[model samples]
Target: MNRRLPTKTIALLLAAALLTGCGAFSNDNRVDPELSLEQAKQTAMAMELELAEMIPDENVASVDQSQTGVLLSCDDKRGYQWTGGMNIVVQGDLDPAALVDAIIDRYSTQELYTAKSSPTPDGGPGAHVIGQHGAGYLVNQSPDRTAIEILSFSPCFVLPEGTSPRGNF
Candidate 1:
């Protein structure tokens, strides 16, 4: 049997349908996974090399590498990725602090498509900071103040400890 619905009932049904179709109204949210800790570190390394290439030969006193790796990884309420990275310290005649700043500035100018910088969680002279675009990259000043540390993934998130990216994160 065919029956006509009341105006109020039909309005309610239409509103419900519109709401469901409108993700704006729905609570459903999705985010792409961030680069693993290892990936983040690698990105940072690449950035370091690229920056080194940019500087005039005479300006750079020296380039040293200490420790480089990913530190932390997590998701947040705002729907953004997060990573904590650490850099290997550097020692040289040039201003270590200035060098690090230059590296970071270049990082912001290039590489990161859309990213913001925040204080490094560990806390140190090495411009510690987190950069995020949808995903996250934990960037740390190298302990030596020469190399930058980028923790692309969380240390805790390991793949059998020894399993490599070929089969691990």
Candidate 2:
């Protein structure tokens, strides 16, 4: 005769295995718990300096604080048809991959939101998440930094009726 485990016992075993495999139940506190808007601005400013060096002709138009994070915009000195901007979210030193995963998971569960892994502009790996409202987020993580950049367009800024606004990527 064959002996089988009870249904409840099997379910418990499966849950345990999943939790352990994904470390979802583990108390690993590697992520930084406190991340403030001021700190994020500082980080974004530094990043902007680096970007300036890369593109000497363009200048940062503005830096402003938003409800969720900071915003940085590139000036349209070249009289370009579109304006480009970036929204930054900085969290203190944390595992970038894990942070990206967490954000993706959080958005994936929401209605009208999509999240997926994307390749960074520099050929590095990153995450890209978007909402139904035309707002989008791009995340990149390094050893010392974790940041999310939002790319959005203002309809009023576009001219000629069909030009697409530039992105901060």
Q: Tell me the TM-score of each prediction against the true structure.
A: 0.35, 0.35
Query: What are the runs in model 1 whose C-alpha is more than 4 Å off?
Result: 1-30, 33-73, 76-91, 111-124, 128-168
The alpha-carbon deviation from the true structure for residue 92 of candidate 1, after best TM-score superposition, in angstroms, is 3.0
Query: Which residue ranges in model 2 land beyond 4 Å of their true spot?
Result: 1-92, 142-148, 153-169
Cα lDDT tens digits, model 1, 1-169, are 2122233432332243233321112122233344444554455555445444544465444454223322221223322222222223333444545655665575556543322333332343332222332233334343334543443322122222453333222
lDDT of 2 by residue, 19-54 (tens): 332111112212222432244334334433332222
Positional deviation of residue 153's Cα in model 2 after best superposition, in angstroms: 4.8
Q: Model 1 residue 133 lDDT?
A: 29
